[model samples]
Target: MKKYLVLLVVPMLFALGCKEKKTETQPDQIMVTEKPKLPETVLDSLKNHPPEGMVWIPGGEFMQGAVPQDKQAMDHEKPQHPVKVDGFFMDITEVTNAEFAKFVKETGYVTVAERAIDWEEMKKQLPEGTQKPADSILQPGSLRFKKTKSSVPNLYDFSQWWEWSIGTNWKHPQGPDSNLDGKENFPVVHVCYEDALAYCQWANRRLPTEAEWEYAARGKQKNTIYFWGDDRSKLAQEANTWEGEFPVYNTKVDGFEGTAPVKSYPSNGFGLYDMAGNVWEFTQDWYNVDYYKELAAKNTIAMNPQGASQAYNPQNPYLQEKIIKGGSFLCSDSYCSSFRVSARMGTSPDSSAEHVGFRTVADPEMIME
Candidate 1:
C-alpha cells in the first residue's frame, strides 16, 4: 500500500489581494483600522503606481510561524520566528480563469495538467523496480476531490477522497465533464508550480516567497491565527473554506461547494482577498520542515528571507516540494484547519489539483529595475 500510495504522485495532496497605493486599512475589529507611516527606505512610487488589479503590501517585521493558539498546526509550521519583508505589490485576487486564459491565448502556453505524464522521468523519484502504471491511467489529467458516500473512520487516508481521474485538466476541473462556464471570475485550479511560473513570467510577476506570503497574509495582525482575528466563528464569513463534515457531506454554509469566485469573501487588512482560503497559493520557496527553526535559531529577525535552499520533508524526502500557502476551500474544522494565516502545506512542484492554485507578486526592486 505504501509503495502504491507513493507511486500515486499525491502524498497527502493537501494543501491574495486587491489593492492600490493607500495604506490598506479597513475599520473593523479584525482588520487594522490605522496603519503606520511607511519608512523612507520603501520606494515612494511603489504604492503610487501599482499594476492593474494589484494592491500594495507594506511588508514589515512579523512572526512567520504557527501561533500558540493554533491547535491544528502541523510539525512543519512550528518554531515561531520573526521575519522582515520589504514592501511589494501583490495581485488583489488569485489569478482568475479569465486572466489565465489571456496568457494562454497570447502565449499559447499549455498547463502541465494538459500534458501527458512521463514514466521515465517519474520513476526516478519512485523506489527502484517500481512497476509502471497502465497507459490508460497516464492520460493527461489531474487529481480530483470526490466526496465519499459517508464519513470514514480515518481521515489520515486522503486517498479515500482524492481520485486521479484521467482527462482532468484546468479546462476540465472535475475530469473531462466539467467546464469553466460561469467560473470566469473563479481562481484557476489544476495549475502546477511550473504552470504558475510560466504565468508569472508572462505577467512580469513572480511567486511570493514563503515569508512574504505569511507576513502579508497576517494583514498586519500580530498574533491571530486567521487574518480576521483568532475567532473561528468568523471563518465562514471571512474566507471560502469547508463548512461541513468534509469529504462526505458539505453543507455549503459559505455559499460554495467547490472553489468560490475570487474575492468571494472579505479582504484582509492589506486589502488582499482570499488570503486565508479559497485556494492554496504557490510560493517561491522550497518546502523545508525545519526552516522556521533554522530562522528562529539565528537570534535576529530574518530580513526578506528567501526560504531554504533545498526541499526537505522527512516523510517524503524522495520527492522535491514547494511551499503552498493559505489553505483552500477543502479546509474545515473537522479536517484541515489550514485556513489560519500562518498555516501552510507543501505539494510536489509537478502535481496539480482542483483545490490548489496560485497568485503572483511584483517586488519593489524588480519594478524599479
Candidate 2:
C-alpha cells in the first residue's frame, strides 16, 4: 500500500534529425478513436466479483500513517492524523488479463499501449522538420526493466530495477520472447496510468483516491505499524516478497518470486486479497511533496489532495508517473518494505511494468445517491 515518492518527471531534449531542442507534447495528449458504448446488459456483468478477492470496509475514522517520534518511520509518513471516508467497495483481487480482455472485447477498445503513436504528436517533441514515423504498434516501443552495472558511483546506483526496452509491452513482455499465453491469470503488467484509467472507465468504475485506497488496504486500524500490525516476522508468512539476497537472487520464500495470481493468499478483514503483496494499484491523485503540509496547514484532513506534478515510471519517460500503492512480489525487506499499508511508490501514467496492476472502485457519490 506504500507509494514511491520520487517518480516525478524530468525535462529532456529530443531532436529527430535536427540539432535544436524540442519539447514533447504534454502527457495527457488528446487522441480520438471510436469505442463501443456499453449496453445496460454488458454494464451489469461486473456487478458480481468473487467475494474472496474483495471485502467491504465500512467508512469511519482511522489514524493515517506512522506516529511522529516513532522509532521506525519516515518523514513523509509523519504527523499522523485522522482521516474519514465514505463507504466503498474494492476488488478483492488485482485486475487480471481475463477481466481486462473482457473489457477490451466488449468495448472494442484498444489500450494506450495498443494504440499506434500519433506521428503528429511525436513530431511536436522534435525540432522543426525533424519529425518522422519512427515507431508504431506495428513496430513496438515500451518501458522495459533492465539490470545494469554501476554507471554512477558504486554507492549511488538505483539503476538495478529498471530499463527502457522498446518491445516490452503488455502483449509481448520481456521483448519478443514473452507472450500472454498461460499467464492470463497473472495480473496484467506493462500498463501506463492512462491505460489503467481507460480500464476503469470501461468497467464503470474509477481508481481509488490515495486516502480511500489506504483506508481500504488498512482494513480497520489506528496507527498500526502495518495492515496486520507491527511484525515483520508475521509478514514473512502472510505475503509474497523478495527473499535470499537483494536484487539478483530471489529465493521465493513466500512461494512466489514474481507476480502471483490474484487472491493467492487469505483476505484481510475487509475481505480484500492481494492488497499487501502483488502488483501495486494506481490512485486517482496528483502527488506533491508538501501535499500533507498543505493539507495540515488548511485545517483540513485533505483539501482535494492529489499527487505530484511529474512522476516517471523508470521504464518510460513519455508518461508522467503517479502514486502506485502496495509493493509487489519483488519487494524485499532490505530494499522495499512497501508492502505495508502506508508504503508507497510513484509511476508514470503512460509507463507499465511486469509488476504493476490495478483494481476498480465505485464512485461513492453515485452509490450514496
Candidate 3:
C-alpha cells in the first residue's frame, strides 16, 4: 500500500513541474495597440501643402445672431441662441483659379455652367405660364461678369450681380474671350453654387455651414462684433473692404479696388483671412431670414439641410437663392452692410457675380462609424 501511494505522489509532482516549466518558456504575449485607419483623403489633407491663407478652427458653441430682447440688436438678428459646431478646416482665402484648376484636373468633373442645359429641363423649371424665349434669343447658359451694364432694371441692384451670357462659365469667365491666363491669383468668380458643390465633392470636402462659417469668421473671440473685433472705424491698414467713398471712388487705400490676393491682409485670431471682406463665400445651408429662428428652435446641427422646404422671403419671389456670407469687395456701409460677422445675404444658386466667390471646408473627421 505504501509503495503504490509513493508512486502516485511522484507522478503528480512530475506533472506539476512540467507545467511550471512550460509556463516559464512562454511568457504572456504582448499586444500592440494602434490607432484606427483614417480615410485616404483625410490623411492626404493632413500632409503638408501649407494653407495658402486659412486657419484650423477647433469648433464649438457660440451665441448666434441677436436677440430682440437684447438692447443692441436688429429685427433680423432677433431671438439669438447658442449654436454648436464640430471642428473643421476652412480656407483663409476665397478659392483662387489655381486651386479650382487642381480640383478639375484631378476629378475631370465639369461645372454646372460648363454643361449645355437641356431644353426640356429648362422648360420644366420655368413657371407654368412663362413663355420660352425663342431659340435664337434663348441662349441657354450661366452667369458671367459684365463690366458693362445690361438694359435689365435690376442689373445694378446690389443683390443682382449676374448677367446671363451664352458662353459664360468658370473657364470663360467673361465669355470665351476671357481666360484664366493672368487671373490665376484672383478669386475665381462666375461660379454658381452647383459649381462650387462639384468642386467640393471632388476634393472630398464641403462648403462651410452658415453656422460654421460665422463661428470661424468670428475667430476665437466670443460675443465680439466683427471678425477682427468690434472696431468698424477704417484704420489705415486693416482688412480688405470698401474704403473712402464707395462705388464711385474707392481710395484703393487697402491696396486693392477689386479683389486682392488671398491673405493680402492680416489674419483673424483663428488665422483665417478675408473673413470680413473680399468676396462673399458660399455656405452649405439654404437662405431664409426666418431660417435662423427655425434652427434655433430645433437646435439643428445638420451639415446641410435643404433650405426652407419652401420660400418665405418675397425678395426671392421664385425662391431660387441660397445663403451667402462675408459680403464682398463691393460691400459698403452706405449700401450693403454685410461686412459684419453676423450679416448674411442670399442670391440665386444659378447666378454669379464679381463680388461672389467661395472657399472649401474639410471635415475634421471624414469618416463615420
Q: Sort the candidates on lDDT, descending order.
A: 1, 3, 2
lDDT of each: 0.79, 0.60, 0.62
User: Which residue runs of candidate 3 sit more than 4 Å off their true CA positions?
Assistant: 1-54, 66-74, 134-137, 140-162, 244-247, 297-311, 367-369
Question: Backbone clashes per model, in order?
Answer: 5, 34, 2
- Which pairs, if any, clash in model 3? 53-92, 54-92
Q: Write the per-residue lDDT of candidate 3 for residues 259-367, one digit (tens) a residue.
A: 7777777877877878878888998665556666765676544333333443344443433456788877766666566777777776667655557789888754542
Work out candidate 3's RMSD over C-alphas: 24.4
Per-model TM-score versus the true fold: 0.89, 0.74, 0.73
User: Model 2 segments beyond 4 Å from truth?
Assistant: 1-54, 68-72, 117-139, 146-158, 303-320, 364-369
**TM-score winner:** 1
Candidate 2 global CA lDDT score? 0.60
Query: Which of the predicted structures, 1 or 2, would earn the higher lDDT when compared with the native?
Result: 1
Top lDDT prediction, candidate number: 1
